[model samples]
Target: MAGTFGNCGALSFFLTGYLQRNPNASAAEVVRYLDAKCQGQPDQSKRQHPQIRARYALNGPLRL
Candidate 1:
């Protein structure tokens, strides 16, 4: 998985679990949750950086 997806694998795995738990989550909410999980509490010792760094350009909340 790491060889194929690199750091994105971790992000995808986490996001998958999050979506499974919050099936009604919106796009904005998903981004916020990912940001908080990946960036807000980073592991400095491992040199971890956020995989998600941009926001979507949608006119309204995009539900997923």
Candidate 2:
């Protein structure tokens, strides 16, 4: 809970929620977008992934 790896569930939840709201969104947009949305919760983001960091961009550092 102090790094960007152990929060798979939260990441998936966030992405899923975002995608539900935005059906055919871009990866970069999603990631960056999510990053901004969660910026206020730095503590929860302790286990954030690279893809989450980069807004889900496959071209970015995707955890998958």
Candidate 3:
């Protein structure tokens, strides 16, 4: 349902996979990483960290 739709989106799927592989990273670091990968700077996408965190919390930890 709604849960599947949110997690299965391409960006979220890739982000989840990447974050899972880098569990030692702090969320700020993850935000910076994601921002860099998205062709933007960390400050430019500063808003995404909380969104990612929220999604991570809601969706559960990426398993594997």
Instruction: Please report the candidate that would top TM-score against the real structure.
Output: 1
The number of clashing residue pairs in each candidate reads 0, 3, 0
How does model 2 score by TM-score? Answer: 0.46
Question: Candidate 1 overall Cα lDDT vs. reference?
Answer: 0.54
**What TM-score goes with each of the models?**
0.50, 0.46, 0.43
- For residues 1-64, write the lDDT of model 3, one tens digit per residue: 0123243643465578778899788888877765555553222323334555576543422222
Question: What does candidate 1's lDDT look like per residue over 2-63, in tens digits?
Answer: 11145454457668889999999999999888777655333433232333322322232222
lDDT of each: 0.54, 0.58, 0.51
Q: CA lDDT of 10 in candidate 1? A: 48
Better of 1 and 3 by TM-score: 1
Per-residue CA lDDT of model 2 for 1-64, tens digit only, reads: 1234344555566777789999999998897977775555546435546556466432322232
Please give the distance, in angstroms, between residue 57's alpha carbon in candidate 1 and its true position after superposition. 26
- lDDT, model 3: 0.51
User: How many residue-pair clashes does candidate 3 contain?
Assistant: 0
What lDDT does candidate 2 reach at residue 18? 86
